[model samples]
Target: MNLELTASNVYKSYNGNQVIRDCSYSFDMCDIYILTGPNGSGKSTFLRICALLENPDRGEIEYSSEQRVLKKDLELRRRITLVLPRVGVFNASVYRNISYGLAIRGIKGGDFREKVNRMIEFVGLRNKKDQNALTLSSGETQRLGIARALIIEPGILFLDEPTTSVDQANTGIIEDIILKMKEEHKTTVVVATHDKDQAKRLGDKVLMMNDGKIIPT
Candidate 1:
């Protein structure tokens, strides 16, 4: 499931305040891309537009694979995922939270349970599998959000400021998970971060955004 995302001359605005202006870039298959910028520089907005959670006022976000452009449909949306800075959680168990995506896709039973357990362990939450998700700490909650995203095994994963709200230790854990995701899953990853060091740590290619445009390398 190799995927390519191309944003051509994309523009977005809110209340006449332009956030992203004439931004364009391509996300190649199986590579980690980092969008680095200061807050209000439109990194989040660009990620949202590319993730299809929001549409651009001008220009298009096109997704394609195997040299053919794919239609913007439910199937395409399912192939990708976006984890925002503030992760939304269900008032359920850790297992339930991680299994939700697969469950909705009609995946269940022993095999499904096994997959969910693996994800729990992957996020270092195996010991808390039965705990209520809303009760977890901020760092653990972030890990759970990532676990939930990974359980679906998306072809493209968009992570927005993954470490912005976590402690140093949890940041390390999340970074490990992302690295392993690249090595094992080969999922194309797009991470938005304001930390220059973090961008260097995770990005195969660092895309710097300032004033709503990509700074060419």
Candidate 2:
């Protein structure tokens, strides 16, 4: 497996309360890594660090490809998109919500439309594309959030408890889409969830975290 992302001796704290303690791990390219733990077990914090949303107090994260090296934070961010546990939909149409990331990245007109339409279709939200994003159900909103993330064409994806707010049908749909992403796009996925069933279903490797430490079981 290729080492797409690596963290070495990572430690973090908030007001002297240690959250992550000397944790180190590597994410392989095109593989699904599941971080399974109880609430407040530092899974999301670890993911935030990997996504570069938050800087580690002490650690080094490296990302690279075969021909190009992702050395800077900006380069890594472009390649890795993080979907938070709570879906925050913009007060806009579902189409806009799906196309927002591309719009911010200077993609407009037909290019953005093509990508957004494909993503909405992939997430099975094509019918709701014209509806207000904030008016969608929790499950639809989560699917919309995932579509938004996928529109960025990220090489690595970080999902924090992606199934929490979703219904069974949508959860199954999202699971299929994620499996397809791994098979087709070869995107490395790191998911943080306390759901053991989901971990077993999607994870190629499971990191069981507890009490601020990763138990390599």
Candidate 3:
């Protein structure tokens, strides 16, 4: 597999408090990595930098592979999607919410319906497809969040605490989808979590972070 993203000498600080310090890492295509650490360890911050959501204080972040190069933030963001835990969906119906990315990317008209419908069913939202998004329960909302992220068909998927505060059934559902992503699409997956069981089950490479640095395993 080719290298998808690389961060060299990365650093971040807020109010003079350093969150990520000289964090350097690289991810390859189709690699699934899990980030684990205690609270305030900057796991999410590192992920944000990789996702282009936050700029590092001092670092070079780049995305390149054999087939293409992501030279701009918008280009990179379009391919690198993030699904945050407890994410708030926009006020819309579930079907509309699932197709929101497609609309934004100018993928509209009758062509989008089949893709959106497939994603809705893939996330097991067939019954709730026409319901209001805000009325769904937390588990259902999480499913919708995952579906929204998948609708873009990102090359690299970053998940922050995906299973946090969710019940076992929902966790299983999310895990199933993730497995399919890895097997079918070969999407590079980076996940931050406190669940050791999940990490063991899903991570091909486990990364342990502490105080803004990754502890070498």
Give me candidate 1's TM-score against the actual structure: 0.98
Clashing pairs in 1: none
lDDT at residue 149 of model 2 (Cα atoms): 91
Per-residue alpha-carbon lDDT of model 3 for 1-217, expressed as tens digits? Answer: 3338878999999999999999888888897899999989998999888888888999888888795666856756788888888777888899999999899999977789999999999889999998999998878888898889888888888999988888899999988888888897778889998788898988999999999998745
Local distance difference test, per candidate?
0.92, 0.84, 0.87
Candidate 1 ranges with C-alpha deviation above 4 Å: none
In candidate 2, what residue range of length 10 has the lowest lDDT sum?
Answer: 67-76
Per-residue lDDT of candidate 2, residues 108-190 (tens digit): 78877888899999889989999999999887887888889988888888999999967898788878877887887777888
**lDDT-best of 2 and 3:** 3
Superior candidate under TM-score, 1 versus 2 = 1
By the TM-score metric, which is better: model 2 or model 3?
Answer: 3
Tens-place lDDT per residue, model 1, 64-157, is 9999999999999988899989999999999999999999899979989999999999999999999999999889999999999988999899
Per-residue error for 87 in candidate 2, Å, reads 1.6
lDDT of 2 at 10: 85
